[model samples]
Target: MNDTTATLDAPTADDALTRPFPGASPYDTYVHASLLNSLQQPLTEAPDEMGFLVTTQVMELWFTLIVHEWRTARVAFAKDDLDAALDALTRSRRALTALSGAWAPIAALTPARFNGFRAAFGRASGFQSAMYRHMEFLLGDKNAALLHGHSGDRAVHEALGETYREPSLYDEVLAFLHRQGRPVPAHVLDRDVTLPYRADPGVVETWRQIYTGPQHHPHLTLGELLTDIAELVTRWRSEHVMVVRRAMGAKPGSAGSSGLAWLQRRAARPVFPELWEVRGAC
Candidate 1:
């Protein structure tokens, strides 16, 4: 190549070597990596604390992404936009997997290691995570009681209340299905959106039809996408239980819910209930 060709190629070749931005690079401007890097202020000198704090924060970020994507999916389904809904669900599945993988750093912390730093950060726990609650609400696990817990913080409470009153991503899916000629019942479609979603046989039958149909069908693809999401979320809960067990045994959570036992029960509850129930019939 000649010098002109070489100069044109220089930009591509020197991508790794280039640091000559006029100010911050577009990436830094959009992603704010410098600010993110400065966030890990571990409260104690304990070696394990930083890892624990970062892991929790990483999981919270993943929760935020998943919630955002699920809301995207919900709105898409509301409009009968299957492609958009699937795209969002696909993004959310990746986020959930990342969220589950985040447990690795603190996965092996023994009770003594956890105790070394746990007390320093008083009155905080995963139980108090607003982002995680948003994820749960997106999955149709609407708990008015949990939403009420955020009342003291008006901004958090109002944000959470919006999700609480809005139809869940799953609810929108059923509505989309109904529009597509599926037999989602009148009561289910018209039910109070603020109420916690209950598993209905009608919803289960709708999934059964999709699952029993052509494996490559679009609706079936949606079913599988939802199943993948459900399984990943359940895996995260299971990991949380294991981590909490290893870190604190049966001790109450810092936010006060009988830690291991409470998480165990919460983990036992299934997500996308009809998707799983349909499997037995299919």
Candidate 2:
């Protein structure tokens, strides 16, 4: 093996604690881990509450990172900077995988353990997570009802409402493909930006062209990257459903929906529907 590979494979001990630094280590100043640690104020004495709170906060941070990456990809796509877009997408994919894994801390909580702290928070649930909604909006999961859920908080509602009105990252992608000589329909490209993206047959055909084209083409690489992203998004939803099922069974959600059942329906739908549909034809 090469020296670089061997070095990467080697293990190092006491690398963090043994290191010396000035006031507030560089990581602390940048990441504000100390400030973050102070935010986990569990409202109840339940042992599981801390894990649940921390897990949710961690997911929020991942969601924020994923949203930032997606916005970068969207701008790169708009400028026809395919390599930059691809780099951003790859970063978002890794962030999405980490986000999915963030469920572990609270993944297997019993209904009893969850109940111990569920009522203490009243109507607060993951459903009210603004950063999570930002990630969804970028994926074209725009929902007016979900945006309205934050009306009590003017700043949050305005930010979410703006996203709800904007064309999603997928919308920008199709526009990019059209400029690259794909046959994406003008109607699909011009559809109202406020609505949730639905599967379009013409869009499916456009993806089919990419799939049927010469192997190793850049557009095909783009398609595969998008597929990876789509799969990751579905995985997150599935994991959420699993976590909710284990913690609440068929009971109503803290947000008023039929907890596991509601999430099950949401998880059943694909994020990039046309991307998945095109696979069958190819």
Listed in order, each prediction's TM-score against the native is 0.92, 0.90
Number of the predicted model whose TM-score against the real structure is largest? 1
In candidate 2, which residue pairs clash? none
lDDT of 1 by residue, 66-137 (tens): 889999999999888999999999998888888889999999999999999999889887788898898888
Task: Specify the poorest-scoring 10-residue window by lDDT in model 1.
Answer: 10-19
**Model 2 agreement with the true structure over 1-282: per-residue lDDT tens digits:** 999999988778857687788789888999998999999999899999999889988888898999999999999999999999999999999999999899999999998998899998887778789988998898998888889888999999998888888889999999999999999999999999888899999999999999999989999999999999999999999999988888888998887877888889988978889889998999
Highest-scoring model, lDDT = 2
* Span of ten consecutive residues with least summed lDDT in model 2: 10-19
Q: What C-alpha lDDT do the candidate models reach, one value each?
A: 0.89, 0.91
